[model samples]
Target: MRRSFAFKCTLLVIGWLLVAIAAVQIPARTFWPAAFVALTLPVALGLNLAAALYWLLRNWRVAALPALVAVLTWPHFQRGLAVHPLHLAGAAPKATAGQRVRVLSANVRIFNVYPQLREKDPASPDKMIRWVASNPADVICLQEFYNEPRPSRHDGRLFQSVDRIGEQTGRQVFLSRTLTNSIGAEFGMAIFSRFPIVRRGTITFDKLTQNHAMFADLRLPSGDTIRVFNFHLQSMSMDEKDIVDSYSSKAGLKAKGLGLLRRFKRGMVARSVQMDTLMRRFEKSPYPLLLCADLNDLPYSYSYDQLADHFQNAWATVGTGVGSTYNGALPFVRIDNQFVGPQWVVDDFRVHYEVPYSDHFPTTAEYRLK
Candidate 1:
């Protein structure tokens, strides 16, 4: 009788966790607490699964609670991690007109403008820029991109990335300078294309924030046009040092924890507004969209699901492992992502873990337009 009572308690607990996990899909606008649910999702899922196994033989009734939640959320779990490592595909098909196109997306963190980020390696910045220029990908979308156009105003003129990369790769560059330094260096998101850019523009989320999205319509060599959106969503602005300080005996946990929670709440609200704007564009797009973004939120977040549920998450379709992209955050967090429209076929996708020049790793994907 005691064993049966314990089993019932376990089922009740698992059911509540499953409900919270499901709440992550609710927009932060509707329910702010939903934003924080992503952080708890992994723990909830693990405990639920463990309980299901623990009760499998002892009580099939208790096991059913977790079993149902597991099956129901299987689609989200599959996209979050590619459990089958060896089963992922290899080798992108050769470039065939507009059918096969390779693209690269990254948040280069101002190319280590603050050398401290790269441990003061001056050459790391130049190396990063050159590596990107040399990549054979047909399209390159970058966030937190910095460039200097004129040599007369600033010493940074020599590092005019847009011109240097364009000259090296022979790709048409379309960029929006969202922020400018007092000395003349410009910072913004950019899209470099091997094909002609027939139209280009920027979507401004606010007058002050550096975060924004840009789109370019590229006319492929085969004459088909596709719209590509490069997005940098509201950053969580989470500093690793603060995360440490929160646990430090020297500091009060209540004070630090509240500070972190405030920022979390702000970011959650801001991202929802931004996503609503992006979704409007997504619905009205005239051509197929290849979305490349530095979401600054984990895959478990609501924004990630909203986009992934609508478009094809390239990684979920053909990637391997946990697909982590953030350098400062936890290991399992994947904030950088690429999603394609229905007409596109993802051939190969990669999280460039070897290139550790910034806080975020780069991602590449090869797609074929049907």
Candidate 2:
């Protein structure tokens, strides 16, 4: 009887987790609590997989339950893991002309503008800035981009990174600066393209932080034009210290925990609203779309689904192995993404884990207009 009772309880827990997993598909706009549940999807999925393995050993019939759900939601599973662990660098075939545009997207943490962030490889000229300028991607979308047109009192340098990258790559640039300082330091989202940009525009959020997006229409050499939207969404702003303290601190555990919870919820709700606005404007885009974003939300969230609903997520479509792009205290999280419209094809996608110059490792994808 005890054995039977234990089995029944396990089944109940499994069913509850399955329901919660499904519940996360609901928009945070409609049900705010779903946001928190979405955050648990990764853990829930891990447990569900474990339970399935347990049942397979003990009771083959019961194992079918989780197995069926896993198969049905296989696409969602692809968000985090691809069975095949492909190479991240120096493996893919080179792009051919007239049919391909290799794109790179990164936050770059303002190219480690502050001196302390350059601890990884400290030098006179920031190596991160130099790397970006020398990058060969046809199109590059950067967030938290910083440009100091002249030598500044703050940093004691001339960080004309924006112009330098544009000149180095021979790419036309469109920067949507959200903040400008007295020292001529400009920070914003930027899109650099080898193709001529015929048009450009910006989308500012409602009473929010400096997070924003910019769209550029580039005319390819093959006489094709595509709109590329580069955006950085609402960040949780959870610093390394905040995350470390939440678990390691002995004093005021309850208060620290609550603060973290509130921050998470606020970020989710903010992203939901931003996503709704983004979709409303970009859905009816005049040309084929290629969206590169630092979504600041997880793949399990409604914000992710909002964009994935219309576009093909490059990671889910072609990425292999771990999909994390963030390289900070929360290393496993993948908030950076590249999405393409129905007519676009993703040939190769990679998160550059080898590069550790910033908070976010760069994501690159080779796309073709189909």
TM-score of each: 0.90, 0.90
Best by lDDT: 1
Tell me how candidate 1 scores on lDDT: 0.81
Q: Write the per-residue lDDT of candidate 2 for residues 70-117, one digit (tens) a residue.
A: 776676677767553443554655445337988999898877777787
Local distance difference test values of all predictions, in order: 0.81, 0.80
Task: Return the number of clashes found in candidate 2.
Answer: 0
RMSD of each: 2.8, 2.8
Tens digit of per-residue lDDT, candidate 1, span 111-182: 886757668576777778988999998999999998877764434444689887786679999878887888
Clash number for candidate 1:
0
Query: Which ten residues in a row are the worst by lDDT in model 2?
Result: 83-92
